[model samples]
Target: MHSAIPHLIELQRVDHLIVAVRTEIETFPKRVREADAKLSGARTAVAAARERLVNSQKDRKKFELDVQQWKDRAKKYRDQSGAVKTNEAYKALQHEIANAEAEVAKAEDAQLEVMMASEEAERRVRHAEANLKEDETAVTKERKVIETLQAEKKQQLDSLLAERERALAPIPEDLRELYTRIAKRHHGAGLAEARDGQCRGCGMRVLPHTLQELRRDPNEEIYRCESCGLILYTLEPVPVPGSASGSERAASSAVNHS
Candidate 1:
């Protein structure tokens, strides 16, 4: 039972280490995915801007073609004006040519406006593309950093897990289960030292009888905090052999009871 005190301490340390490792592993990937999402949004914006630029350029070209067709029609009417024999007919043809010319001028102006707008849109597309590229580059670098960190964490966690498994191997199965349950309920601290007749975990005063029982043998039985359900170790000011503090004595007394 005395020998089991060290095993209990080792088991508690293992639980804490495993908890830390699991937390880091779980959160690192989320951060990486968030960075990826940002890059995707930037790329989508660039693509939308580029599509608008293309549509604007197409509209400009269609307007220019319409203007050219109207100009051709006006030139044809002008060339045929001499063939008209009646003065009324000649004046009517000239009026038609003037109207066609006006239409052509309006179309040309519309085409110019469209071209200017397309140029502006093209510039916007270029700017968006640049921003997207920059974001993608940043994402790539951040992902690499995340990967490196994850790898390092994984390596350390694996080593710790191995050590923890070894440390837990000697603990009796029932006691091990009890420790795990308490750890899960108490946020990784299954073992708490009894310090100056108070539970270190919750600062609750220990009953005099319980303190006397705890001081007998550290490894007799598993002693738990009445208030918090944590395994209790007595912290005595005096140092004992094979014990770091007086708490080991309390822990050893409990083991003896167990």
Candidate 2:
């Protein structure tokens, strides 16, 4: 009975490793996907900024073409006015020239507006591009970190699995079943310590008679915490608050009551 508790404790330790590694392995992909999503958003910003710059340039080009076409029309009208003989014809041609000049002015104003906006558009594209590059680098670094972590966890998983099998070798079938069921119910933590007449798992005060029985058959008897249903193991002579021996305190803290 004295040896059984150590075996169970050892089994629990191995199980903990297995559970932790498995959790990390499962969540790693989701973390990577989230990072990828951020990268995609940054890239979209760069593309949108570039598109704006291209559209602005296209608008400027169209305006310039319009200005040139109106200017040529005005010149042709002015030349035709020279060839006109009647005052009515001359006045009509002058009016046409004025209208053509106004069209040219409108086109020029539009061109100027596009030209003014082009600088800002280009600046935005550059800024977005820089941000994209930075985000890409960050994504790459995060991917590498994930990969390294996954590899390490994979190695650890294999080792833990082997250790778990070994840990199971000494336990009987009934205890194993109990351990498995309880562990599943308690997030892979099947056992808890009873200390200072209290169940550490659920903070329930253990009865004096039960505590005495637990001390008598600490390893042989299967003592369970009534409140939490965790298999209980006792550590006698609870450490004092300010005692020189801090080992028990440290052990208690590390115990996975949760």
Candidate 3:
């Protein structure tokens, strides 16, 4: 019957929603970050693939230069063979030319290997780039959605705050302060319903005297559960036929006449 009880209950309900909304708002950033991380990983993969392609191209270029140098060496040895007067010198020059040609062939073979690897690297780069773009687009879209949701939640929070202020208006300032403190300590539910002489918040039994006082007191003094420090409230109990305060008990207690 306390004037502040209904307002406190409304305040608790609004606070509960506020806490949930705030918790959801907090997770939005983490969720967006997770999406960004995925996009970043895709970008890294593309970069690695491009680096491999570049290295493979460089290797191919080195091999091509090696082949050109070996071909030039063979050409020089062939020209020197014409100037050689001794048969031994001429044969030696031909042998040198053969070695140079072998070197050129070896270089070409390595160049071909590098070309193949470069092609594979290029393919991977293209695939990774495509994946990166897709991931980036997806993340961007997701972020927009998350941002919209966050804005809506912020608006909702503002409305709830205004509603909470309205709820507090009907409550006495001191009682409102006490309720707010307790609600903060107990996750936005400072009051507990008492049913069948039990504190629902802490599952503790209320004392008989306390229960009687709660039911019979006209002053509307607030009661709190000793175990959990939560304000306790009770609904009016229904009268029974045979129990205490019932018609049957009253009749049995009445003095009988002869």
Candidate 4:
């Protein structure tokens, strides 16, 4: 593996983390809006229910005033009852009072209906208000949780961005430009692991000689995949030592003596 490959890999790691954190942070606004939408809907329901309640109250008041006016008219007709001398006039006066009393009965019935409707409207308003309060509590809690998560993601993104600069500092300018170009072409993935005789990025076969060279410990060659043009790195196997360490030799000597 080339000496620069490790630094490039580190830089790529930081970049990937930065992008992931940014993507997560971006969703916070939409989440807040969704929560707020529920709250807004609850508030609208409460407003509509209150409006209905107010209309019912107005209707009840109108019926009450109508009943009062009819009662007053009936009283006026009764006062004129004793003053009338003719039999037909007295009968007509009594008839007017009866009509006014009937109107009062009708108005009282309508007022009773209006009062019932007003009670139903009050029930609806209470129900809507309860829902609004419940929704507000839930939305407030949800927004707080979202805000906390967003803050954490922002911190992570800030740390990763600073680390990216550190990782990029040691890499040469030309190599950095090459990496940037390739990463842009490949959607922010410029490095690919070469393993199992294949390029992991594009699944293209790696040549045996190039594989052997990458496996070599002291290799300084920077390899790129022919098909996808992505820089490749390989995991070198750990070499087993043929000789024993001092601790092992001491144990072996002890066994021999025993």
Candidate 5:
């Protein structure tokens, strides 16, 4: 056990380092995802504004065409009025001309309304387009930053993984497998320190004899906790204020019958 103690300590250090690396790598993509959502929303707004502008322009064009058609009809009626022979025919021509003029006036008013609406629509489209351009620029910058961060994180992770491989190289195959299995079950914390008569990982009290054996072994080999089956190590035990010593603590507790 004494011969394997250094290897166990090395393994613990490697696991801690890798855990830190994994955490940092996970955060890189979250930043880019947030930026992408913002960019997509901006694009949608721009598309809606452009659609409104197109409809407004179509309306304006139709109204202008109607006004021109009514003006032409009014001219025809005016010419007919001068050539009319009968009084009734002349009166009818005059009435037709008045009706054509009214139509032209109404058409003109419609055209004006459409033109005003078109102008407003165009203004909104331009504003949206500008906003979209700004968002695109921001997205580009954010993507570049994300790429840079990913590259940096990859390099760091590679280095840490290499160190982990080195640390595990000297450990026995069976021990390494046991450690890995425990790590998987315990969310990466395979080993726990027994301090103050307590297993740090699961908060279970360690027996006096178990603590004695752990302290006696100079080479710390892998040892499982009796209660939680977690790997345990003995460092300098921290004395709990007003708590009993190892022998006294053991004597006070009910023995495990099992």
Candidate 6:
């Protein structure tokens, strides 16, 4: 690894977290809206049910009035039957009474139908009102959960931004420019770990000279992957278990697995 690679790696780490936090925060509003929509839908259903109930009540009242009118007409015809002097006039009065009675029966039937409709409307209003309370409670809980996650992600984003600034502070301007350009193309991964002669970022084979240069302790020469153009780095070897020199490892185990 070059002298400046560590700082860039740190910056990349912060940038990745920042991107993740911002992406997660972006979803919070939609989730909140979904929760609000459920509540709004419940409220609309209740309103519609109440409106139906009200209209059904009005219709029942109108049918009741119609039934009363037909009853009154039948009563008037019966009263007039006594004043009829001729057989034809009395028969006409009887016919009128029969017609009025038939109308009364029809009106009563219509009124009964309206009353049944009103009962159904009342039942729907009750059912809707019951669901409305549950929707309200569920929306409140969902909103609270979304809002809490939103706040937490915002805090994480803020902290990452500050840490990014600190990580950027130690890096040189040229390195920062290079890292930014490269990271933009690679989703915040500006550097690749060089291990087993391969670029970990892109799975491309690393050149022998570049790998050799990177394996040097306190390396100063900056090298990039020929295939992917990402700045390359190599991890120091870990000591084998119970080795005499804790600083070195066996040939087969000379690797930074982490």
Ranking by lDDT: 4, 2, 3, 6, 1, 5
Give Cα distance to truth, residue 41, candidate 3, Å: 2.5
Mind giving the per-residue lDDT tens digits that candidate 6 earns over 151-176?
99999899999999999998988888
Q: Which residue pairs clash in candidate 4?
A: none
Model 6 residue 115 lDDT?
92
Q: What are the per-residue Cα lDDT tens digits for candidate 1 across 41-132?
A: 88888989999999998999899898999999999999999799999999999999999999999999999999999999999999999999
Off by over 4 Å in 1: 217-219, 237-258
Candidate 4 stretches with Cα past 4 Å from truth are 216-220, 238-258
Q: Which residues of candidate 2, in runs, are more than 4 Å off?
A: 205-221, 237-258
Number of backbone collisions per candidate, in order? 24, 0, 0, 0, 3, 0
lDDT over C-alpha atoms for residue 32 of model 2: 94
TM-score of 1: 0.85
lDDT of 2 by residue, 108-130 (tens): 99999999899899999999999
Give the Cα RMSD of candidate 3. Answer: 5.6
Q: What tens digits encode model 4's per-residue C-alpha lDDT throughout 1-258?
A: 678888999999998888888889999999999999988888999999999999999999999999999999999999999899999999999999999999999999999999999999999999999999999999999999999999999988888989999999998888899899999999899899888889999999999787877777777677888889999888855334553465577789999999
Taken over the whole model, the C-alpha lDDT of each candidate is 0.84, 0.87, 0.87, 0.91, 0.83, 0.87
Order the candidate numbers by TM-score, best to worst.
3, 4, 6, 5, 1, 2
Let me know the TM-score candidate 2 reaches against the reference structure: 0.77
**Candidate 4: residue 206 lDDT (0-100):** 92
User: Any idea what lDDT model 1 has?
Assistant: 0.84
Worst 10 residues of 3 by lDDT: 249-258
lDDT-better candidate, 2 vs 3 = 2
State every prediction's TM-score relative to the real structure: 0.85, 0.77, 0.88, 0.86, 0.85, 0.86
Clashing pairs in 3: none
Give residue 178's error in model 5 in angstroms. Answer: 0.9
* Pairs that clash in candidate 6: none
Residue 70 lDDT (model 2)? 96
Estimate the overall C-alpha local distance difference test score of candidate 6: 0.87
